[model samples]
Target: MDEETRAEILEATNRALCEHGYAGLTVQRIADESSMTSAAIHYHFDTKEELLNAFLDDLIERFESKLPCGAADPRTRLDGVLDAVFSPKDPDSDGFPVAIMELKAQAPYHELFRERFLDFDGVMRGVVADIVRDGVAAGHFDEADPEEIARLITTMSNGAHARAVALDEHPAETRRVVEDALELHLGWTPGEEVDG
Candidate 1:
């Protein structure tokens, strides 16, 4: 009912998500993890779907809030976006993509889950498209189609996240691949030099 209690519930949900896949997520489990009662959780989110949606919305809001300061040049903004999204700060940040992917793989059987997941994906696509458009106008990036580029970036980010989660690839390597994708596909240069 209070802010602290709400945050604890959200934190518990994330922990449950990491420890137990979507199928295993339950109000009782989350309450136990948070040292609260299931009734408290029910007060905040009546259904499992609502709880999951809140968790995702919170994560996306955090992601949006953490974007780096915008630069005049699009390429710089693009770099800033990458850095913000891939930053290794949030404990579940790196694994979230994979976890979502797994959830998506099951969404068809659950309509609410599928719609919520797709809604987030749509938000991500729109955000990326806007960034690409801004970059193109600034002359730092080529004036290619923004929608296509946004889709490409989203796909690459998803793939990179998947690799990081699935293969246990170093974040540096994932970052390299992402940088290369930007350079080759969008005509942006990496800010750092590669020794290899």
Candidate 2:
């Protein structure tokens, strides 16, 4: 298939994921959503696993695009990353936070699922760690272990997502919960939530 077709397939797959969740996602549904035949999807991806991986690849791209992990200061970068992780807007219309929570539940029994989760988690953790290190270096944050802080931030963010899903709260409320957690954990000023 051509690049455009492949992108269309991925887009459909992403929508299917949001609409049906992981258990209900299928190539037929994706094809239907994309106005293509299931055979066309098979031409690109031989198995459901392959298609799911493609979905994850697309999601990772969206995550990076939506949550630009860049800033001059580590503290500011940390805030930005937190917002990206917990905030809802769903700019890509993927319902990513909910999908992530579902995947978290699926990771234990499925190796492929676990691997995909780890891949994105690794990227997020690395970004978090960099922000922590930069903050410490710039005297914006207290001296601490960057790696540990990164893991903590990642864990907290994921937990917040899960909580948001479980509580059926909007993204802003989820972000507020995470912001409060971060402030309590890192000793940031207990002020208003930072704007994204």
Candidate 3:
């Protein structure tokens, strides 16, 4: 129940989810991956759904931590988010996103998963919307509905994630497509030199 133990469990769950997909995941597999007994996992999480929900919470927290805060420039903040979303470190490792996609596939049938995903999606869109709003206010971006722009960006990113995971496409290719979408829809591109 300590933080270290919980983190270990989550890490193991992530590996299991990535290797087996949600449909194939099993408690014994997670236990084996974590090098913990099945009884230990059960002591921490009463059910598989509970373990998955905990993993989702941890993922959301990590994502939020990556977003810019304080007085960071709007462009810098937006770029940070874009890079995190489209061109994440270790582009070849699709474990995190693949696990997320697997959970997404379960949303239709599981209310708990659906609620957690909705929360995660909302936070992501909210972060993008905030950046767009700041950019527009700073005259670095075209005046548009921030919410709409956020939705477009989220949709495009989701598509890219799916394609990258499914086709084993390079993350750079998805990054280019996302950048183009941002430029076309928001009139803003990360790291672009602008005349004062």
Which lDDT tens digits does candidate 2 get at residues 50-138? 78776776677767776645664566667667667766655676465676677677778778777888888888888877777776677
* Model 2 Cα shift for residue 7 (angstroms): 1.9
In order of lDDT, best first, we have 3, 2, 1
Q: For each candidate, what TM-score against the reference?
A: 0.81, 0.82, 0.89
Choose the strongest candidate by TM-score: 3
What number of clashing residue pairs does each candidate have, in the order they appear?
1, 0, 0
Candidate 1 lDDT at 140 equals 56
Better of 2 and 3 by lDDT: 3
Model 1 clashes, total count:
1
Candidate 3 lDDT, tens digit per residue, 1-196? 7999999999999888888988889999999898799899999899999999999889889888877783687888888887778765464444867778788888898888888888888998999899889888989888889999788878877888788779867566767777887788778777686454
* lDDT (C-alpha) at residue 38 in model 3: 89
Candidate 3 clashing pairs?
A: none
Per-residue accuracy of model 1 over 99-159 as CA lDDT, tens digit each: 6766767778777677776776787778777877786676656667878877776776777
| Candidate 1 residue runs with Cα over 4 Å from true position | 69-72, 89-98, 192-196
- lDDT (C-alpha) at residue 168 in model 3: 68
